[model samples]
Target: MTTIVLGAGAVGTATAWYLRKSGHDVVLIERQPEAAMETSWGNGGIIHASEVEPWSQPGMPTKIIKWLGKENAPLLLRYRAIPHIMRWGIEFARNCTPERFRENAKSNLHLALHSLKSLQEIGAEAGIDYDRATRGVLKIYRSRDSLDSAQRSTDYLAQHGLLYERADPDRCVELEPALKDTKSTLAGALYFARDEVGDSNKFAQGLAAACAARGVQCRFGETIEKIETRSGRVQAVVTSKGRIVADTVVVALGSFTAPMLAKNGIRVPIYPVKGVSITFKRAAWNAAPTMPLIDDSKLFGFVPIGDRIRISGSAEITGYDMTPAPARVAAIIANASFTFPELKRYFDISKSKVWAGLRPVSPTGTPIIGETRIRGLWINAGHGHLGWTLSCGSGRVIADLIDGRDPGIPVPPPQGVVVARAA
Candidate 1:
């Protein structure tokens, strides 16, 4: 069968790769000149399966309310986005209950672990050189209360085969010597020994090349204008270049998936949560830490990719706004420097690259994958902040469903999300 995979980011490229391997003629479409030029680019670079809890945990509403409009706050809600955010906000709030959060975390962790394994296999099979490291990830907390809260979640994940260890301040510095400078501020840390980190853009590009080598037609720089349907199934995709007929169409457009599918009478409740990242050249090989580190108190992370260090974090509840806020970018830099003080001297804004991309977040924080209500139409989107972490696994699952085979992973429709079906 011929299949058209929309949006050639990590998710779409992975989907195309798996589908071609499954004996299907695949075509990948993208608006950018190349794959992974958007959200899949400049992410935190950690495949964090151990940290799969949804952001809408208990007391989140109170935290968001307290952080609203604060300049250096971790989450910022723009006033202009209020009208567009109301419906999604209501659904998001409804999922904030403790019961719902745990259920969602369980599902997310299942996909995340599967994705890490898939990524490793792909890297080995394709010889993908993405500066990947299997040294695990360290998440440090500044307060005892925060560390205690994290331990609870860690314990829950431990029951499901996740390997982790709690580290005191001295042990935390011992794990990553770069943290030696910040020992005064650190309280404790949790290390996930199995987590991995790598450059996602390089992985996406490498996978896309592999897909092309396997006879998948890649149509980059073409904007998809519409998805045509007939008799309750996808017929063709109308693009700025031309229309392409397909027996199956998979939507992986990230935050843009909602609007494109809405035109086809499918309402996917994905909100555009904007995030920022800055990548700078490492001063010296030994100056940066080898392992990925997340600062839970500051809500940012530091990743060493080859000779470069990526400082990324900060969630802005803005609607489709990709403008790079200098303040927010500076805040990320400052927060990251607090954890790795040497970063202050090495980070040169003139030479560094800063980026902002919208994460297609579902209220429940679980990705929506598999056949939708429309026959021959499928979705593998709304992975949110875990898009890179879950990309390969989600793509494999969608390919399995497209081939009418068992996905081998649990995939249920997102709770309380109202998706319109075909008549």
Candidate 2:
């Protein structure tokens, strides 16, 4: 079977790599000159299942209201420019119900845990190194109320096979002595020992190389023009370079998957949620922190990749534009400085590069995976904020669907009609 995969980000590359391993002729298409030159680049590289809570949780609605006009709000909605942002806001609020939160958390935990194991196995088999670290993830809180709330959510995740422990402020400083001087800012913390971190861009590039070595045709710098179908199955995918005939097509185009399908009359309710991150060159550490750090109060996180530190967070519902906002960058810097002051000397402030990527977000925050209404076409997008964390398992599940094998995990029901569109 020949499979055409759209987009060459982490998800797309992983899909191609696994599909090729499944004994299929895989051709990966990308709009960029190289794989992972888009959203998969400059990402917070923490692979965590325990930190898999949806953003639309109980305490978010009121907080969003308070943050509306604030310039540095962790999750900002630029309401002036995007009126449709309100619709997403309404839908997001609807999912904040206790029942929905619990359901989404459980569902995400399933994918995150499975994906972590799959990622480890794939990396070992391919002998791919992405500066990997298994020092776990520590989420620190700065307020008592916030710390208490996180405890409940962490407990919920831990109950569903995500092992986590509540760490006292002193314990947090002990885990990462870098936090010793900042002890006054800490209220408490939660540590997930199974969580790991690495460079997502490096991982994607490594996997792409592995796939090519396995006879997968990774077609970079090619744009997918359209998907031609008859009898409810994809026949061939038309691209700017040429027509790619395939027995199956997997729409792993990240945030663009929903819009591309909508053109073909598929009503996939996926939206682009903008996110930002900055990478700093590492100099030296008296002792490098062996863990990823998340500041709950500020809603931002920093992950170590060898010597460099990557800081990322913020979700703005501002459509397809890739414009970088200075205010958002400032907020990220503010949060990062508070978490790790030593980064100031190591990274040149003026020389630092800022980047923003649109996350393919679904209303429920859980990725829409499985067979779609269109035969021979499957979707593995909408992982949104958890794309890097969830890609490995999603690739395996998507390949299973293509191979007509039972996906070990329970698959979600098919979504409604999907309209396909040209890029």
Output the number of the TM-score-best candidate. 1
lDDT of 2 by residue, 170-204 (tens): 99998888888688889889888899998888899
RMSD of 2: 3.2
Show model 2 residue runs off by greater than 4 Å. 284-290, 412-423
Cα deviation of 60, candidate 1, in Å: 0.8
The estimated TM-scores of all candidates read: 0.96, 0.94
| Deviation from native of the Cα of residue 350 in model 2, angstroms | 2.3
User: What is the Cα-based lDDT of residue 100 in candidate 1?
Assistant: 89
Q: Pick the candidate with the highest lDDT.
A: 1
User: Which digits, one per residue and each the tens of the lDDT, describe model 1 over residues 1-423?
Assistant: 889999998999999989999999999999999999999998888888967888878888788889878979888988788889888888888889988888788888888888888888888998889988888899999999999988997788778767899999999988898888889998899999898888989999999999998899999999999989988888999999999999999999999999999998888888999999898877654668877999899989888887888889989998898977999998998888777877767668999899999989988888888666677888889998999999999888888877777777676454533243322
